[model samples]
Target: MDMMMVIYNGLLSDEYIKGQATGRIKFYEYPPTGDISGPYIVIDPLGPPQSADYGDNIPIKDDYLYQIDVWTKNRLVTKELSKRVQKVMRSIGFGYFAGGVDEYDKDTGIYRDARRYRGKAYTEEFEI
Candidate 1:
């Protein structure tokens, strides 16, 4: 495996897209709260990727497109993994959604609100 790829997987590389593989977004369901779900990924059980230490003299390249390809593959798998979660949420009459976030205000965050409810009852669903 490429050293850069290792760094990407370790989530230490600046070139890496954080949380791109596991796409889970905060969401809620109002009204009857019947249930709703969205796309997700599924990871297969397998040993870690083949890797070997490539000392300090490492190289990075623009032609290193495999990183993006691998990320895509991983994302697809992760989407499959999300099936289990969707099933569980549906069973409980909840909602499930996933996506990337550009920013967040964690300190004073208003997570979920029903657009039809006139913002009278806001609920915060913590990530489990």
Candidate 2:
């Protein structure tokens, strides 16, 4: 399953809209080039997927771990964005159990809060 697409769609869902008063925000799969404004989210896979036991080697279920970074000029805004992201991911069936402010870049004046979520997609049946 395309986990990034799932996350992107969830952020644009109605639930996210009603949860915050923030204006139009940008979302990127990876870091973007050129000048950009505050209040944007970046979704990136942390690393390669680790093996989860697949009974009978059918591969009916897949789990991926990813990182969602919320960046903004204001610390409070960053935190709020992170919370909304967590809610959205949860709504989309992702299990988000760990996250926190990873770092603050003084050079760019951006506060980034990173969240880790495990997304699992399963099929009822799969042919070998």
Candidate 3:
């Protein structure tokens, strides 16, 4: 489960994601303390990975559910970055795009698009 975060953190380093996000791409869901403003991304696992497939009663694969959040002041950037993130997620074998929902922080006036994805371990992207 923890390794999935590492995989996502490693795979989301594409140029589109890097260029659009003005802030850091953190591993946790919560935003960092203080005002490190501009567009940012947060990656977090929903829960423990579910065991799938069995080989001699031993688990052979695991299903993972993860959430990727895009936060920004601009709606366009949020939407575009969300797509770019989906692209990256697909590239890493996260074929299950569970879609996203719009969220706003009234106090900060920041827009967020929270997207969910499901993938399996031992796939092309998840080597471990």
Candidate 4:
């Protein structure tokens, strides 16, 4: 449930900023926050310095945090794709992603109360 998307590069349209124009800016939810960083464009106090010690660098935030760099063209076949993604998450009882709790319910079949989803005892199985 973490499917997000954002891609705007229409020639960098002068970094529009008139009431937060969003004619089509998919997802720049605002992130840049001072001190220069990398990759988020729109900060050229006079454009030029981008090396000799973080010169033209201005992107500590302007929204661009996509994180997920799991590379593997065949790094030992990624341990067989991580054991086939935990063997399809154990045939449908997903036992990981504990950022919440034992959760997985393709409609109703594996939910060790990830904080009881929304209550009503949540479905999938977790009756204790």
Candidate 5:
């Protein structure tokens, strides 16, 4: 299954995320060119899914790592969204790996809050 799609759908499925930033999530290395603009999010895979568990010579569970960047107009919004994002991800079985690297984009005047999560699960458990 597509892991990034799963993460994107997981975020999209949350009520807070739905109401706060519907259709504002992007799954790519670069944010789209002025596409719907800032106050959006970007999800990037940090590494390929690796086999975590095996039984009888078969892989039963896989591990995944992804970085989610929250972009907004100010620090308060970024922090609030980052908290909601962390909660939503944990609810979906992902655990926080790193986070809260807040920065300001001089060019766009947008605040970026970067966070990472790691999860290990059976491939079927991720079905959305």
Candidate 6:
């Protein structure tokens, strides 16, 4: 399965996340026109996955980097949502890293807190 899909599914399956923001977690970007309320999450790829290690000219494992952004109008809600995202990602076996916060958007009144995680998964391929 694709890495993002795996993470998305995991988040969807999480009881806390599901109960709080059912069908609100979006991949890549949010919908152009819809009820884009606060307290939603957006998953974005940081970059391409890199080979964690190689053996006999083959990649044994791959490391993927991703950023989960929690956006909300309220500061307290933003913190809570970010914590929920962190818990979900950790439960999925991702290594947490220091993430930065963004300045409050005056125009949209949205506050975004982003978290970065690294997930490792095995891969297999054979040379012909």
C-alpha lDDT values of all predictions: 0.25, 0.67, 0.73, 0.24, 0.79, 0.77
Backbone Cα, N, C clashes tallied per candidate: 11, 0, 0, 9, 0, 0
Best by lDDT: 5
- Order of candidate numbers by lDDT, starting with the best: 5, 6, 3, 2, 1, 4
TM-score of each: 0.20, 0.71, 0.78, 0.17, 0.81, 0.81
Ranking by TM-score: 5, 6, 3, 2, 1, 4
Output the TM-score of candidate 1. Answer: 0.20
Tell me the lDDT of model 4 at 8.
26
lDDT of 2 by residue, 11-124 (tens): 877454334423443344434432336466777777665555487875666677878777767788778778888888888777775755567777777777888888767643
Better of 1 and 2 by TM-score: 2
Location of the lowest summed lDDT over 10 successive residues in candidate 4: 114-123
Of 2 and 3, the candidate ranking higher by TM-score: 3
Better by lDDT, candidate 6 or 1: 6
In model 2, the Cα lDDT at residue 25 comes to: 39
Question: In model 4, where do residues sit more than 4 Å from their true spots?
Answer: 1-70, 91-126
Q: Is candidate 1 or candidate 2 better by lDDT?
A: 2
Write the residue-wise lDDT of candidate 3 on 18-108 in tens digits: 6665346777756753353777788888888888766677777788888888888778888998888888878776765656678877777
Q: lDDT value for candidate 6? A: 0.77
Task: Note the residue pairs that clash in candidate 2.
Answer: none
Please give the range of 10 consecutive residues that has the lowest summed lDDT in model 2: 17-26
Check candidate 5 and list the clashing pairs.
Answer: none
lDDT by residue (88-107, candidate 4, tens digit) is 33343333332332223344
By TM-score, who's the top model here?
5
lDDT of 1 by residue, 29-106 (tens): 121221223321222212223222232543221111111111112333333333333333234332333332222224
Off by over 4 Å in 2: 14-36, 48-56, 97-100, 123-128
Quote the lDDT for 95 in model 4.
34
